[model samples]
Target: MGVQGLASFLDKHQNIYREVRFGRSRLLVDGCNLNYLLYFSSGLDQNHGGEYAAYVTLVESFIAALRSCDITPYVVLDGGSDVTDKKLETAAKRREDRIRKAHEAAASGRTMCILPRMAELVFIQTLARLQVPVAQCFAEADQEIAALASEWRCPVLSNDSDFFVFDLPGGFLPISHFHWREVRQSGSRSSVSCRRYYTSSFCSFFGLRRQLLPAFAALAGNDYVKLRGIDWTRFVQAGTGTEACGRLEGLLCWLKGLQESRGPLEVLEEALGLLGDLSGDKRELLQNLRLGMEEYQLGRSALSRFFLHGAPPEFPALEQEAGLVPGWMLLPVTQARLSGNVLDVLRLLRMNLGFGIETQELPSANQTSRPLRQVMYGLLLGKDRSSPVVEFDRAGLGPISVPVEPTFTRTSQRLRLDSLPQVALSDRLNVLLEALGVTQESLRLLPPQLQLPAAVSCYWLQTAQPPPDLQRALLLGMSNTPRSTAAFQNKSGIQKVDVDVSHAFSQWQACLKDAAQLNQLLGLPLPEPDVSRLYQGTLVHQLVHRMRSGGKLKTVLRSDRPSEELYRSLLSVVRRIRTRRTRQTRQKAATRRQQNPPEPSADLQRLFLQDEETESEARAAVAMQEELRLQEELLQVRTRYRTKERSNRSKNPDLARKEECRGRDLL
Candidate 1:
């Protein structure tokens, strides 16, 4: 029947067959074969253009039908670029032969040139216009198509039965007239009956038990060779008959022997023995298989070694027990496909064999199923070496615990400001202020060095709330005399206290200005209330003064010799004012004594005698009081010396001696 007739017939009888729906079904087609048929067929006479239109229409119709059935089809094409040089030459010869035949036919006027060319154009145009998803392989179209189909687990549409040659596990069905026949037969009988007929027929004709179609084809050669008038019976006989069967038997026997061997060397010895028994083409095939297996086994050994110690052998042997090369040893795509198969086989084997059981030397049913592992084991055993048993240290996967002692617990060590000497603290504060870039203006009012005790005290007053005692002490020290204040109030000023307040306020304002300058120098951000600025400036001055003087008056109660010098300098300034006041008082007293010197009378003289006696007694009492004061002073000195000696014995004697010297110097 023509294509249209066939299509119409299939459409009419579509419901006759029981429909089977595939979950996530996809159809993979051989584009090259389809295109070739279309291009060569005279049925697609596209020279008149009408044939090309018809071809396009036919493809569209087919696509529409597929869409209606919700079947997605992926078409694959071959570019003929991947063909080997030898194959290319052969293809060229075949093409030439076809062209010559066409030319001869045209010359005879038996068949028109328009017919073949039109047919070719129609097929090409039809395929090009196909709306379905398509992929094209550079070379080895069959291999690419088979691989993709296997990967996607899609049904295949092809005239060649080679798709089954790969032995893909599931979801691949060959489409043909045979399928239509099966469908029709199923409708006439029961659905089950039709399925059984096709299934049994396929098994019996193809020997489907192991899906050994490839092996059969390898033995029988091509059926078309006979059609082309080539006598391939001898080749077929040599491949499938006594010799081929014997070779397979010998191979299986060798596999069994390798399984029994102690190591890979022994397996290799058995393989060589099997190799020695084969001859001619069969011998060559067996040798190739052996080499592929040896390479694969070597790859496995290397991988094992790598997993164990992060480095593999330079050249390990390949195992060839499965006839195919090891999946792990192949190039990416081939390796991916083979690895998938290997994993599946391994899973199935594992399901039956269980985990953690050693079956290295034995080729059980589990090993037979897992072709990859079987090959590896065989290579190792044949080569006379036992595969290392890798046992994972599961305990290494847990958290590590460290024992710690209570007495050795971690603690942060920080310097205690209270423990620092006033001079040392002052030096540290000066360093800290300098590091912070405190300005000279802020430091001008201070002594040369800054101390931590004064700095810390000033810092607390600035950042923290000032203590009541400290605030009271500061106010008391800053108090002005009432006379000076009153005199200023009467002399071109407001109230005397107001005058003092105004002067103090101006000083405070100057201090704030100094603070601002210091903030700029120290890279501190300006405060909104400017309290921080004021505090920092004051702190710098105080800390520096304390540091320079060697002892702070406010924080450190005890005064050392260096501190006494600072106190003495302040006292010297105050003493000048005190001395001037004392001199004025003496002058006033002298004038009073002179003015009130005498108003003497006779009765006063008589009274003076008795008064003189009372005066004498008063003088004696005053003398006795002075002696008692001296004795008390000596007793205090002696008591202080004894207490100090005891304290020195209890503490660091050297530190005590130094402190005593410092106290004596200050005194």
Candidate 2:
């Protein structure tokens, strides 16, 4: 977690950072931070679920830039939330903020830097494909990243404000200043020119001791320690637009007065004492402040041997704790094959922060994927499914955490978590199919990669509230297929996102993502998805428009026989599933109606007996419900045909005049 306003404060002082031609060095990349920076900065479509194909291209280009400069990069990612709950409040607060921002974005149609759920998967998979060295830490990767960077004596490239506080020997290269695209060449060698930050320079410029950086971070209110009631801005001699930045300056100025001879503990005590009227207990505040400072204290990198010798990092501390993570899963967890959400579900009986945007009057996109996650929880918790997993999700304009029961079908109920890996591949595959409610025979016709997407589409059609129709589903399927990567390249400008359509696809992607993870947990019973091939939102939405106007599917496939075949197979599977489900649903309803004949309610009977008008009103109400259902379906299409017509009329004065005369004649 970064210190609030620290990055901005350092950015103001140009002397704190030195211009350098960065090359021919080992770079320890903060994978999580870099993922956010790369996606948000690239101007990719965020509102329309995601533009994964474009995102994949961007990631490849970034890696290519580093390779061209001969920079050996080691990427580190955060695994799960800290089990200790030190940053629990901070994480929750940020989640709440994101939820609010997401609502605002949904309402205003403005981008809120919401990284699409599939973006992380795409990033990690792309790196794996490119043969980059990557590691996922057990907890927040900040300390681990700092530790590894310190040990390797390499610069950490990230835009996280937390990096400014760490005293990295090789220094910090902020992504904001990292002009990686502008590679400078001098005869035989090339380098990425950028600004580098050294903590020593920051401390010296502020006239404070290098040893006191941690103390400064603690006083300035990091995520771990936000000392309330103290008005730090009051001490500011000068102010900036951001109050937090001014407080940071004030804190540094105060630290400058402290004696260099004083130890860290002494300096911390002095800073805590500055909280004249402490909001909480003084002792507790002191403890938190100490913990905050301790976050920056690095040890010998735990990942060095893992990076050098390819041995997975051991978590003996976690292993000793009974029923934390199974010993078998430690390797996959480190390799980033399994989602860290599994750890959270197991450790705390709660899954934190399933991020997505919510639409008004529409069920949460997550609601559609709840059953899929429930099965995932079953695979994770196994025998321990008595207690439900509390899932944090966006509800309306606020964040809500609700307990979700783990679902164990007949097939998955027998699989034990500890021995899951030892189970036969067929049995594992059975569990995946059972969870998705599809048979192996159903998926056999499609490509292995398309199998999961097709299965997920079937589930989406069956379960999604206000379900997507055949044409939309076909468009989504085409967009997700690998062939579509080349068929529908990234377009130039942002297209207006259809919220209803976007939400439906978001639900589908969420289901696909969770199912893929469960499949990974079950040793990849289905082929691993190339996420880059799946769901380019911009292309998918464009295809939807084309399909709306009666465009031929062959044009999108570009007459590529293999692509056309894949599309047809995917469509056939979906159509068969939808048809079977509809028949089954109707049969079930017929059976239920036959078993329990509906009786008119006493009120309805009395109303019918009392007046004919009341009977007509009841009939009208029934008709209204049908009308509303039709309207909901119509709204999902969100066709812009009328808007386009109006635009054309506005552009051509003759067309507008002709339309006006035609309207008068019709009247």
Per model, how many backbone clashes are there? 43, 0
Top candidate when judged by lDDT against the true structure: 2
Q: Of the candidates shown, which would achieve the greatest TM-score relative to the real structure?
A: 2
lDDT of 2 by residue, 1-667 (tens): 9888878777677888899999999999999999999999998878877888888889999999999989999999998778778888988888888877766666678899888988899999899778799988877899899998998889999988889989899999999999988988898889998999998888777778888889888877888898766666566555444334466777776777667689888987776677675666888988988999999999888789888986677774555467667777776778787787777887778887555655655667888888888988888887655579999887776778888989888788988888776788788889888888888977665555568887888888888888686445453545444554454544324457767777777788878888888887887888776877767776676667666668665555663644554554555566666565665776798698678866768446655666775665576567555544544333322233245556888898885675454312211
Off by over 4 Å in 2: 233-245, 277-280, 316-320, 470-495, 549-554, 557-559, 586-667
Q: What is the C-alpha lDDT of each candidate?
A: 0.32, 0.77
The digit string of per-residue lDDT tens for model 1 on 289-308 reads 34322221111112222223
